[model samples]
Target: SVSVLSYAVIFAASTKLDITRKDSIKFICTFAILELVIELLYISYYERKKMISLLKGEK
Candidate 1:
């Protein structure tokens, strides 16, 4: 998430610096895809851990 946000900020700044439209679009799409993947992985890991704890009567 942090990485995604950082990339977005950098991309925005780069646009102001006169970066090409195509490059900006590419960067934004790449970061968005990466962010989605990271979030999915995180959610899956968290849910699995929570389920394990519940089954063990730890929560």
Candidate 2:
């Protein structure tokens, strides 16, 4: 899953930087928020195109 992969990457980076758990969690949360926004945009675009195609097919 992307969530697991993202968390794993964050933890690895944090360890490399010698940061604390708090900082790592903060980065993970920010990344999740950004991912949500991007996912929404992607879904919206995909659905819009699909509906347009279906409408065209009906006509």
Q: Which model scores highest in TM-score?
A: 2
Runs in model 1 deviating more than 4 A are: 1-8, 16-18
Q: What does candidate 1's lDDT look like per residue over 1-59, in tens digits?
A: 88767887978786897779898888788878987999999999999999999999998
lDDT by residue for model 2 (9-56), tens? 878988789778898889888988998999999999999999999989
lDDT of 1: 0.86
Clashes of 1: 0
Candidate with best lDDT:
2
- The 10-residue segment of model 1 with minimum total lDDT is 10-19
Instruction: Report clashes for each candidate as comma-separated counts.
Output: 0, 0
